[model samples]
Target chain A: MTLPILQLRAVGKSYGTVRVLKGVDLDVKRGEIVSLIGPSGSGKTTLLRCINFLEAYDEGEVWIKGQLLGYHSKGRTPQDRDSEAVIAEVRRPVSMVFQQFNLWPHMTVLGNVAAPLVLAKKINKTEAHRLAGLALERVGLAAKVDAYPAQLSGGQQQRVGIARALAIEPEVMLLDEPTSALDPELVEEVLSVIRELAHEGMTMVMVTHEMSFAAKISDHVVFMEAGRIVEAGPPARLFGKSATPRIQQFLKPWLDRSLSI
Target chain B: MNVSPEHIELLWRYINAMLVTLGVSLLAAFIGMAIGFLLNVLRICYPRQLSIPYRLLVWLIRGTPYFSQLMIVYFGLPVIGLTLSATQATVASLALYSSVYFAEIFRSGWNSIAPGHLEAAQAFGINRWQSLRHIEMPQALIFALPLLGNQTVLVIKESAVASVITLPELTMTTGEIVSATYDYVGPYALLILCYWLLAQTIALAVRGCATLLTSPQRTL
Candidate 1:
């Protein structure tokens, strides 16, 4: 069997005394779309953050392409942790799109997209701009290259956020509630961009509230509740014939809303 | 308000002193901004170690009067064997005075940036220095522009305090002319006019900079 591109082994994270992620174990292959769905405070976002080492997991380990992230050991102490430069290098293959569409408001769209290339990848300015132009074109924001984030609508700004992530050419894209901050109309445009990326065989781990979209695109759906994974399997099995009562109860509101629509 | 040839000659003689006043203010502003930038960076990078000392220094500089600070630099320092020339003492005191205010302006500007901007920079795997240069510093400087302009104006006005140290700047030169010609109203009024014109020029230049820095096209 081929080794998974990303793996999480009993990952746990805590804030002081309160635990946010409780023993999360997961795996992702080369080209898979894994949708993490749960109610708020269920640690879905924390789990996604751990995968990219954005939030260091206190117990267990996260491995991307077989290299440990955040720590050299599972020991819960500052001495066991890797240096920041080492952490950055180990997680170089991953890029994240934040829920708030965290584009630098002071920069133009092209500058925002080109920033990661120039700053992280150490690419030359002229080539970075060329690649950034391509990424913007991919998101259909080619004309808004010189436009600032404040001038764009919510949907357009989120697209620029996605362009920024794509400019780095990451092997896995982690999106934390990409559409949660968008308006009803604007959500569709951002969703379509992700859907297109999914079709092109991009590996993604997403925390999303759109159950219908998740059921449609997800190869596997992992249901989380109160910082633990309650059920994990294909969307057809989980959404169509859920084994756990917790998952069934969780999906009922979403199912009812979809049927009515 | 009589038109006298003597007053005109005195004014002409003192033009170089006006230039010296302008030069001292400019030098102080430059040095103060540089020191303030360094202090802000140290505070941000090592808050635990530098915060108390940084805050205390700012308080000490700001609490005391500017003239007293100038006197200390010029007179008191000689007791400690650190004697400085008049111009040196004046510029040193002025720079120290201006840095504290500049540091506070920069701190407020840094606080105004959204936390997400820095997070985004980190998520992109940019190092600390790159993040500061490409994201944090540009935005912070833009936010600080108006207050920075105000500080520049204050610095120019405060250069007058250097007159006590016999720096031969505008105010001191005007006093010399007044004593020589024994014409109080004419020389004093001319001194006020020169200072006013100088202040107006600084204000105009600062406004131009603020507009350029805050403009969307120029910022990008």
Candidate 2:
């Protein structure tokens, strides 16, 4: 069995007694595309942030490629480790693409992509520009390298965001509803990029509402509701006969519309 | 009906003197901006230690009157064994005054930086320093430029105070020529016109820079 690139064992989080995620266990193996399907406020985004340690987990262990991220005990005071050390490791190994496409407005598309390599990795400018060009080309945004983020459309900006992530050469890519902010016409452009990455066997965890795309692209589908995973299986099993009543109820209206159309 | 040629010569001499004072004001403004830039970098990079001292300095400068401060340096410093020439004292006082305004200019610019950009920089693994250099400082300066330009104009107008120390600056020369020639209207009116013209030019330059520096709107 391939060792999982990322594993969260009993990860839990809360904001002043309002529990956001509880006993959330997930394992994402190398080269696997995992789709996390959940309704709004179901802890999907929180879980993704937890993997990168952006949101502190109140309880449990987050292990990345067999390195224990941290061990938090039940009802124990949190120890303050230097976030910079963990941040360097986390930033090196993983990159997250946000829903809103948080591209730096002041930077050009090439500058945005080249920033992480130069700023974080200390890559030289010439090499950084080269890698940035490669990343932009991979996202079909080679022509927009010199364009500022403000000059790009929503889909183009999101693709630039993806390019920025790819420029870092991370092992795992965490996408928190990457295309949800795009218009329907623009969604396909972003999804196609994601689909190509999936085909290349890049490890990815996606929180998405795109049922058909999830069914088509995900190796495993984990259905979550109210801060817990309600079902987990291969996409075929989950979307076909074995889809639980909750998922069925959730997808019924949309599924019926598609069938009628 | 005839005015002394000496008085006419004084007017010419005063115009040259006024030019020097204008140059000094420009130099002070530039130095104050540089110091403010350093202070802003320190505030962002090392906020805990530097902010207190920065606040204290700005407070002391702004709390006192600029003219009195000039007097303190030119007249009072001699008793403290740190005697400076009248021109030097005027420049130092103007720089001190401008720096207070400059620091405030920087603080406003610093606050204007969007937190999202900073977080994005942090997430990219750029340490604090790199983020400020690559992201924050450039962006903040865009917001800072107009206020600094306004302060520059204010510094030029306030250079009139330097004439009190008998520095032979524009305003003082105008006063001397007016007293001797008994024609307050021409010299003083001309001085006002010159100051207004300079202030307007600074304002125009600020407007031009503001247009150049406004970032394009982001779709994301």
Q: Which is the leading candidate under lDDT?
A: 1
B1-220 in candidate 1: lDDT tens per residue? Answer: 8979976776676688889998999899889988998999999999999999999999999999999999998999999999999989988999999999999999999999898888888888988898888799989988887788789878988998888878899889988877877988977888888878887887798788867765656422
Please report, as a value between 0 and 1, the fraction of native contacts recovered by candidate 1. Answer: 0.58
How much is the lDDT of residue B45 in candidate 2?
A: 74
The candidate 2 chain A region of ten consecutive residues with least summed lDDT is A72-81
Highest DockQ, which number? 1
- 10 residues in a row with least lDDT, candidate 1 chain B: B211-220
Question: Cα lDDT of all candidates, in order?
Answer: 0.90, 0.83
lDDT of 2 by residue, A1-261 (tens): 778889888888888989888898888889989999979999999998887766777777788888766432344246643356565565468888989887876778988898898778889988999999999999999998878888889999999999998889889999989989999999999999999998888899999999999999999999889999999889998888664789888778767877899
In candidate 2, list every pair of residues with a backbone clash.
none
Report, for all candidates in order, the number of backbone clashes.
Answer: 0, 0
lDDT at A113 for candidate 2? Answer: 90
- Give the least accurate 10-residue stretch of model 2 chain B, judged by summed lDDT: B211-220
True contacts kept of each: 0.58, 0.33
In terms of lDDT, the poorest run of 10 residues in model 1 chain A is A69-78
